[model samples]
Target: MERELALEFARVTEAAALASARWVGKGDKEGADDAAVTAMRVMFDTVSVDGTVVIGEGEMDEAPMLYIGERVGIGVPPEVDIAVDPLEGTNLVAKGLNGAIAVLAASPRGSLLHAPDMYMDKIAVGAECRGRVHLEAPVKENLRQVAKALDKLISEVTVVILDRPRHQQLIEEVRQAGARIKLITDGDVSPGVAAAYQDSGVDILMGIGGAPEGVITAAALKCLGGDFQARLWPEDDTEIARCHEMGITNVNKIFTMDELAKSDDVIFVATGITDSFLLKGVRYFKRRAVTQTLVMRSTSGTIRHIEAHHDLDKKPLFKDHRIKLLGE
Candidate 1:
């Protein structure tokens, strides 16, 4: 993949975030998601790659666009596989809460795992702790490993987990292990990637999250030189069958960073739709909208933070959608 495509992906997520930010606090998650999906779909056409959606909105029958196997870009060179979450935390955006982002991961064809939409039990840590923790390890044991790798006391380690009933036991185990906890209501991708950045104040991320998100998170971690491990957690026969359809015969197999995002030639980009530990939410100004985005490439091992200001009247991005500005 060319380095120039990194900026193209930034524009894609930025458009999605700007479009969906208008729906914040409206109490309409579906509306916010639609705005994001439509904007992202439109932006992809402006890029110059022959892209296939391996992990996307949904199946062809479920989503109108950006669905699995859907083709994007200008039908050009650098064939790639795309995995996207146009609105990663629709509920967070609808409630005007934090931790919402529009994110995407792109890599060469056959470089990304075709993860089905289901639950995946994940454990992630920074580069320093890579090869130290394992998904099959007990929660306390993993925490202990992270603490030892980071040279922190057990009580100094901070683990982030999704706030859900399913995490009750996981949460308790972490507590018993004597690590601090940060619980989020929605969106685990941010924290999952944040674990790779020591300054992000997130030591590790644990618990189950969407499999599609796990792949996206894996791409970012691979770029950041972080360690991530996960196992598909299918809820029933239906989901298990879905995994098999994707050629995942070993349902209990643990996926490492390399397997999840096969190649180092991967690009991950995300734009914040709401304030969180990793990024700030979009801000509307007089005739301008400000967005903060993170663009990373595993090939170059570079992470770029982009802060773009869009001119409402001049930018072609907003013109195509003709979306009503939030403050206007």
Candidate 2:
């Protein structure tokens, strides 16, 4: 992909963030998600590529837009695989909490895994520690290796995990290992990406999250020269069949960074809708809303932090339609 294409990905997430911020503290998750999806779809129309949604909200029957198999972009440049989470943390946005974001990653056609909407057992680390931490390894052993790789005390290392019931035992083990633990309410994708950034203060990420999110996070890690490993956790026979249908025959198979993204030329972009470890939430003033975004490209290993300001009093993109419908 051209260098300019990375900016387009940023624009998509920026639009989603701007739209979703309006629903903050409104306690409406579906409405927040809908606004983000609408804005994302509209922004994609202004891009210059034939983008296919490989990992998205749901299958075509369920979601109105940004659904799996849905096509985005303006259909001019190279065809690419698109993976998106219009609103990564709906609950966070509803509660006016942290870790909510609008995220996307794209690559050459067929480079990304068509991750099914299931649970994935994931482990991620920075590039220097790649091939050292294994999902099957004992928790203490992995922590020891990571601490050694970073030349830090085990007590000084911190692991980021989603606060879910299934992770209770994992949390206990990390605590027992004497490593610090950071439990997040939602949006494991951001934490996973943070594990790769040295200044992010996240040493590792381990837990089960949405499979599509695991792939998206892996894409970001790949761009950051980090390492991630995951295995699909099919909940039942139906989910197992779904995995098989997606050409995943070995349900217990483990996937590495290369296996997850399958390419080096990838782009990942995320705009924060709420405060999180990596990015801050949008802040609104009397007349403007401010947004922060992170955009990264694997080819150049460049990560850009973008801050934008938009006027709130300006007419929205759909104002003309609403006016015409009301015969104003």
Candidate 3:
């Protein structure tokens, strides 16, 4: 992918974030998500790549826009595969909570995993701990390695996990291991990538999240030279059958970062929808909106934190005005 494409992708996420930010604290999670999806779909039309949605809202039959296998962009050169979460945390936006984002990952054709929408067991850590931790290792063991890699005591290590009932045992194990825990109600993608930044206050990420998000996280971590490992967590025979239909014969196969992202030539972009550790939420003032975005590229190992101020009065998000910038 060309370097200029990263900025183009940033605009896509920014449009999604700006559109969704208007719905924050409105108790309308679906509305916020719809606003973001519509804005992202519209902005993608201006991009230069010929992109296919490898991971997105849903399959074509289930979603009206940005569905899996859907074609995006202007049908130009440098065909790529895309994975997007226009609104990563619908609940966070609805409650005006933190950690919501509009995130996407892109890579050369066939470079990204066509991850199915299902639960995935994941373990992520910063570059310092790369090759030091393993997903199959016990929670305590992995924590120990992270602490050792960072030259900190086990108790000083902080682990991030989604606050879900399914992680009860995993949470307990981390506590027993004497590591601090940061439990979030939704959106693991931010923390998963934050674990790669030294001062993000996140030492590691462990537990289950959406498989598609895991792939997106892998792409970001690849840019940071971090480590991410995952395995599909099929809950029942139906999920297993779905995996078979997707050509995944080994339901329990563990995926390394290389397997998930498949190439170093990947770009990951995110615009914050709500306040979080890595990026700030969209802030609106009058007819303008301010956005903070994180853009990363694996090939050059460059990470850019961008703060943009948009003149909403002059910025028409959609060609058809599908969503009002300030929810007007």
Candidate 4:
């Protein structure tokens, strides 16, 4: 994909963030997600590409827009695969917590994995520790190698993990290895990407998250030249059948970065709906709404941090004067 594609992808993320921001602290997670999905779908119609959603919110029968197998963007140049998370952390946005984002990644057709909606056990580290950390290795061993690569004591290396019951054993292993643990309530994708940047204060990301999100996070890591490994974790026979339907025969297999997102020419963009480590949250004021976004290209390994200001007084797309009359 061309460099200009990054900007186009950023536009999609911006639209999603803007729409979701309106529902912030509204105590309605589903409303925030719906707003983002609607706005993102509308924005895709204006982009110049024949894009297909290979990994998205749901399958064609499940989600109305931005769903797996759904075609996006206007027909034009650069036929590509699009993976999107219009609202990565809906709960976070509803509660006005941190690390909610609107994220997207695109590459040439057939470049991204069409991951089914299932759980995936993932382990990721920075490029420096590439080929050192392995999903099959014991947790302590992985931590030891990561610490040695960074030239830090085990106690000083901080591992970011999701705060879930499934991670209980993994968390205990990290602590046993003398590595510091930072458990987040949700949104492992941001933490997975943050692991690649030293300034992000995240050294490694370990544990299982949504399989679709694993691919999304892998795309960003591929752009950053980070190391990532994952294995599908089917919770039951239904999930196993879903995997089989997706042509995944070996459910216990591990996937490397290349296996997740094979293309080097990948573009990943994310706009923060709430503050997190990699980007700041949208800030609203009487005059304007400000948002921070990060756009990255895998080929050049360049990440651009953009802060945008939108004049809220201006007419928004799909604005209904009737809503104002109703005090909405």
Give the per-residue lDDT digits (tens) of candidate 2, residues 1-328.
9889999889889888878877887787777888888888888988999999999973321444487888899888689999999999888888999899999999999999998888999999988788789999999999999999999999999999989999999999999999999988888999999998888889999999889899999999998888899999989999999999999999999998788898889999999999887899988897678899999999999989999887756736434322111112
TM-score versus the correct structure, for each prediction: 0.96, 0.94, 0.96, 0.95
For candidate 3, the lDDT comes to 0.91
The C-alpha stretches of model 1 lying farther than 4 A from their native spots are 58-65, 320-328
Error of 1 at 232 (Å): 0.6
**CA lDDT, every prediction?**
0.90, 0.87, 0.91, 0.86
lDDT of 3 by residue, 1-328 (tens): 9999999999999999988998899987777888899899889999999999999973321333477898999999899999999998888998999999999999999989888888999999999999999999988899999999999999999999999999999999999999999999999999999999899999999999889899999999999999999999988898899899888899999999999999879999999999986899999798778999999999998999999999876876643477853455
**Candidate order by decreasing TM-score:** 3, 1, 4, 2
lDDT tens digits, residue span 1-328, model 1 = 9999999999999999989999999987777887888889888999999999998963421443468888999999999999999998888988999999999999999899999888999988889999999988888889899999999999999999999999999999999989999999989999999998888999999999889899999999999999999999999999899889999999999999999999879999999999887999999899798999999998889899999999977877676555544533
So what's the TM-score on candidate 1? 0.96
Clashing pairs in 3: none
Using lDDT as the measure, the top candidate is 3
lDDT at residue 72 of model 1 (Cα atoms): 91
Report the Cα lDDT for candidate 4.
0.86
Runs in model 3 deviating more than 4 A are 58-65, 318-320, 324-328
